[model samples]
Target chain A: MTTATDKSAANSETTAGQWIRMYRQMVSVRLFEEQVNELYTRALMPGLAHLYIGEEAVAVGVCETLRADDYITSTHRGHGHCLAKGASPDRMFAELLGKEAGYCKGKGGSMHIADPATGNLGANAIVAGSVGIATGAALSAKRLGKDNVAVCFFGEGALGQGVLYEVMNVASLWKLPVIYVCENNLYTEYTHFSETTAGDIPARAAAFGLQAESVDGQDVRAVYATAGRLIDRARREGGPSFLVCNTYRYTGHHVGDINREYYRSKEEEKHWKTERDPLKLLADWLVAQGLADSTQFKRIQSEVEAEMKKAVEFAVAAPYPSVSEAGEDVYA
Target chain B: MLETLTRELTFGQAVREALAEEMRRDPRVCIFGEDVAEAGTPFKVLSGLVEEFGTERVLDTPISEAGFTGIAVGAAMTGLRPIVDIMFGDFITLTMDQMVNQAAKVHYMSGGAWKVPMVMRTTLGATRRSGAQHSQSLHAWFSHVPGLKVVMPSTPYDAKGLLKTAIRDENPVVFFEDKMMYTKLKGPVPTEEYTIPFGVADVKRVGRDITLVATSSMVQVALGAADLLEETGMSAEVVDPRTMWPLDEKTLIESAKKTSRVIVIDEGYERYGVTAEIAAVIAEGAFYNLDAPVKRMGAMHIPIPFSPPLEDATVPTEKSVFEVARKLCGQA
Candidate 1:
């Protein structure tokens, strides 16, 4: 377990430029999700989207530690991970808008964007769906003599899935280079995770003899530092690790889930938003270190907002794939 | 056809030979499943593979079907050509999400950018008295999915040749071997390397009065029926549409048209199964030419019973198929 003080110490080693970059990336995810929500409200987007508003730190922090060639399998709430892994916002928006210019040529909507260039294997819609894919990629890396590590990103909801434990066991047994990143974002959809999960979460992986750790998901630096250690260990043939990032969701499960008061208290949402916002925490830390000011933060926000606007415009104007394309890509 | 310099091999030996040949041909090929390594599976079909490729390439996983199967999808997407063994066809219920949602849709959902070059090999047959939990012919479930290719090889020659093609193909392929045929069935296989292309039906016997289209275990049953038909002064043509997805519709229709009658046979349940699909194809394509409606035969729609007599009654036997063929040919 890592405490707040240890998290701060871990942040000390990250370069100023990388910290700034991380800040920008987190902001990008936040704004991108905002656009997605707006698109949903305006009825421009076709499907449901699980927004990653409050959990930016987990995706951004862990992804920031990865290389462009490293593989990542994402969840339905995966916009943050895709962007952090270097997926272009334009193609991402295009995919969400069902445009031909999207990463998956609009075949995969908000929940299924996959970009090979960024080694984003794909965002899966199924709960705990990509656990096996991520582990398999680690196996591939080990067998092919590659130093690349794969990150399997899932929510605490995935802990209910048997496949996660199964792959973790295989990964440990084989010493495959992979990390299982569990972002415990308080709620599993509309229900609190406590209602579903049993026993200790980290102990589950530890039972398989995996290196398990828990860190604050709101602390980007802590996630980055811990993920870096595990990933580096995996690359050096140290096998798999399980990381539990304690975090919260700022919005309802999906854009349509407006009556969330039935499941969670509004006060809980407000507290996380106001007191434990990852962006605010990081921005304050940057200011305390004299690396950034209010003006710089404002500038970063504006830049990200503008970039998101352009991406939305591009996706809105992009053509839908031809009808004949429905029959294509099913085989090869 | 290649020169007939062939040696006889059991169905199990043929499948092992295919895996061995593919592993020798490609360094990226690897095997993962329960007891696939030292135990060589309970069937012992994979006995010599671990000795040849070492444990690094041939891995034995825990009894987690979904976990390792899911891993195979990710490994295939990245760099490895993985062949996951699902000890029994009945256990495929555990891997539906991985094979259906992940492996099958990855290529199309990624708009052709990602490919899952993986093979899931499982046994499909009844009457071993392993009861309902161990015995099933569930290949039809995979055949129903668009992006998955389903292969069911009846002969040792077909098993070796088609498995090689499946390993090399750029899409996810499910190969079902009849467990009953693994030891009991033997046929001539060529020493020289050869691969049988999917969607090409092989005519096991040429006749005229009626066409019997069969898959996997049912092919041998159809051939046996054909012999009985010949003894009864009826000429029966037996065609094997080795692959269910890339179906040899042309050959099936041609045979149906030539014979003017058809009976589609498979070991899967009759309702919404492989037989239904093939019968539908013949009904639609060769309706005008067919003298009689295309008949379908498959396992009875019930959990395979444990008793020998009851279990034997579930699947179509040679006598049953012969009776159906005789009736269809207007001889009964």
Candidate 2:
């Protein structure tokens, strides 16, 4: 919400090394999702996976500002969040494939994978499911004198949920160190967000006395700058912020079986993919700044693709969890 | 074992003492809910906690069950062991997504990698005339979940001891305190700290004719019924399975086998309720030992009415339980 200091604009004040690392994470998530898409199409992965193809910048930008012990609550489309929060693709892919070596030991599959060691509290399938969790984590940080901050990621669809407002009310009232990032992808399932949502989202958050702002999610630098300011402010006990990121999804809500064309024309989808793809936008920005050349970007892309390939191989070769383990995790 | 002196304490005082003691014993323990801090919640069960623990620990939350319940889960997932005072049991329906879905499934879905060591403290039962919205014994709904532990304490002693154990447990626990008994139920609670482990049922009365398995507010009702049966030259055993989910099936089934007749009493509605579950466990485990079929008694299927007389009729009275027991024992 603090727009006065746009340090990350053009990757300002951030080192070239940090920029490259961020770029690498975004690229890795993009290609890893591509591999996921291939596996889903080939029926190699069971159940459905929500792809984070076009929304990579939001995760990378925000997570770059977080400490390793800081927490985040995610959404159904959470691959980008996990990867950006430092969950290795091998375990993530293993989770998606229901492998024994997966982050969740395959129990959580894709939509529910959790890697607590990496500060990814876990992903939730229910919309706005973890808003309270993020707030509670912030409450813990404040009460326990911990320096950790908790960031919650949901969609514009979550704005309709009353719990979001409830948690926001307490969070702002208590000045808890939490960040609510709403990735407004313009779509909630097959419907446009506007069809089900009312008025403005940031304005609604502002009504809760929150420091709310809107950002272009396709621009990694803008997202990074805004999220960095907000997260830093949160770490300093500056209360919570509601950040609305205007973004889009390149694929259907879930993998396979759903005809997204029935809801919106392919032309509308093409507009976002061809013009506003987050990864493409960041890559283009890096090339323009001379931070990374096309050949170097291509090299990075190949390296990420190879990394994703290895991840898939590990997942495919990993064993399934034993049936004996099914009854074990029900309690402590 | 430490020899501890027992002091008379009301259920309300016992619960407050448990919270204060737990918070004092463990820095990780904190409590939050509507009207909990400044107003001491509706029942005053958290009275004086804010003064002792400060608002930083004994926080008052905005009225949002879904929001704060989720926060408790999140805080529990991190470092803090939170006790969420949900105010009323009926309102827990507002938090089903968090309780039934997230908190209940986190540890399991996370493949035992994470533990949600939190307790949801709420008031249950219908005799308070607080209307259907505020009056309900909804413990049965929570006991149905897998990862969640549900406990309903009928006595001050049980309330204090079980709460300490619940707070120390490395899992989510839904603790139900009887609303009507908060001020009226008094017992000799040990002044020293003690914890009653889950899955341990206490035999309040010994008998040979019939085993009466009771829960929450119904425990007293079953005891009253036992007294009435005793006057009629029929002895009845009363068993209180303190924790409903990690139910002490061994004690219950063994008692049922010894008596050769059993009756399950719950304040919740009968059809597919806690009674059904207990009866199923007995039928499946100790069917051959039964001389008579297991009988179940619970509140009527209709929502608890606002009228005192109607509400009294909905929940099982001592007379109703005695009648059911007499019928089960062929003494009617």
Candidate 3:
């Protein structure tokens, strides 16, 4: 249990401006995904994409605490992380369209999109692959004597991987400034977490003797408060921390899945989407605080839609990279 | 003044001097590995680096090959050049995801926006009977991955120059060194700085009867075989493909066409090895010009043994390479 002082400290750091930014980013991500899904269904886009609809708070809340130069290593479901870390949608969409204007010049597509200029080391297709990489980045930050920290975004499914344990032990042992964020979205592809994962992820982190916390991922404010304190502690004390965000994914594992009959029920999905919608929860809080009226919210929604539409148009009209460009990026 | 600086240096010492000098020359160059500090590295290849560069740059990781290697990749992505040493080449399999998926493909995947100017230095082949788990020549595994440059330098001069080149190149390179040659070899390394470009071959000895293409430690065996053949009235042209992945195929093809007979010597297993691929390419390109079959001399299809006799039997020796060439010459 967290002490009363720690809880109050977290509460004291919550600001209206911070809450507004989180809600806006979450809504923007939701709108962007909807547009991409439509494009994908219409065959206007090619290849696979792992959606992060229900896990918006994990990305937005955690990224809100990071500085611009702070690094992040992400998993396959990295669109939310990339956006939360400030990757523009135009290049991301262009990347999905396999155009020369794409983030990875059409080479990485969805699963491997990245912007090193913004400190994203690219999302990895391999499960649990970036966990250690993020720890390494934090190690570099610590070695360079900088207050910066690296965030490692993975899933509960990666808990069973051996390298995760190895990195946790070393990060803790060396006091590397890293934050291990496990976005527990209840499933790894088609398998349920309960069926595959043994023991609680938070408890596993505690066993490793690091500070561990579990946040209500549906509440963006709660996530932001918890992640902010941990990130601050990492920067100040020069060590590692672990937080497991209990969340869900609205879409299937990847794009183009027709049914949900194998593992999860449609009723359960609807329950999470309706009752635990992260965007709605944040919007409600913002409205209750009198931060903005409903008309203003509607205006924000329209602006987000326009931005996403522009991104889609740019992606659709962009040309694919020439064959000669294939060998160019192998070096600088 | 062109004063000659002749100093006896081991292959490992040459590597350390190169790293020290490069670190001093460029602030971006950093080193990381297990026991690379006071413990003096697994093979002592990084002896005294931590002292010279201090602990910040010459980092001593806690047996986290994947973590440190990935950290090096992340650092490289963020404008620093990192040289990571894996205690044994066999351990590279542990970090294949970072090396192959991230480090190798990051630049290409990022649409030329990012460059993984990183080097992974690992010792290869059985030398001190380190057993099956520690000794293996798996350079072919990395060769199969695109967007990566591979280098294997056998002599002190080549080790320093090639490593310097690898450090400066705007691409990820894997430097596979022979453990047996680390202390036994000596070469007149110049005091002034130098670099050898990639996609090029070095003609160690010129002859006309046949052409021998070798890499890493096999280059030494091929030279020994050449000497034995010379006394027997058979001249052989020897070519060392200093860099394996971006192979200097033009040089090999030209030499094979001139000699009209070809032989490949490799320390790795025979099946699907670099030798097999080179032979296939030559057979397709210069088949009509060949006066004899393209013979391949490589290790048997088995893991390296701890026993001296079995280890020697597994790898290709000078006598074995000579026998293969003799058979190709129809003199057996």
Which segments of candidate 2 are over 4 A away from where they belong?
A1-10, B1-4
For every candidate, C-alpha RMSD to the true structure in Å: 2.8, 2.5, 3.2
TM-score of each: 0.97, 0.96, 0.94
lDDT of each: 0.92, 0.88, 0.84
DockQ comparisons of all candidates to the true complex:
0.91, 0.84, 0.58
User: What is the C-alpha lDDT profile of model 3 across B88-127, one tens digit per residue?
Assistant: 8899988888898788887877777767788999988875
**What would the per-residue lDDT of candidate 1 be over residues B1-332, giving only the tens digit for each residue?**
64568899999999999999999999899999999998999999999899999998998888899999999999999999999999999999999999999999999999999999999999899989999999989999999998999999999999999999999999999999999998899899989899999989999999899999999999989999999999989999999999998998999999998999999999999999989999999999999998888999999999999999999999999999999998887788
Worst 10 residues of 3 chain A by lDDT: A1-10
Off by over 4 Å in 1: A1-10, B1-4
Best-fitting candidate, measured by lDDT? 1
Across residues A20-72, which tens digit of lDDT does each residue of candidate 1 receive? Answer: 98999999999999999999999999988899999999999988878888899
Q: In Å, what is the interface RMSD of model 3? A: 2.0
lDDT of 1: 0.92
Candidates in descending DockQ order: 1, 2, 3
Chain A: TM-score in each model: 0.96, 0.95, 0.94
| Candidate 2, A1-332: lDDT as tens digits | 22223432335578667778888888888898899999999999999878988898899998887778889989989999998888999999999998889999899989998888888888998888889888888988888888678999998889888989999998999999999999998889888888998888899989988899999998888898898888878877788998998888888988873677778888988999899887778778777878787887788888988888898998999999898878888888
lDDT of 3 at B67: 69
Score candidate 1 by DockQ: 0.91
Lowest lDDT 10-residue stretch of candidate 2 chain B: B129-138
- Write model 2 residue lDDT over B1-332, tens digit each, in one string: 86789889999999989899989989899888888997998788888999999988888887788888998999898889999988888989999999988999999888888889999998788878788788877788888889899998989999999999999999999999888888898899988767888989999999999999999899999999999999999999999999887988899999988999999999988998999999999998899999888988888998889999988888888898888888888888
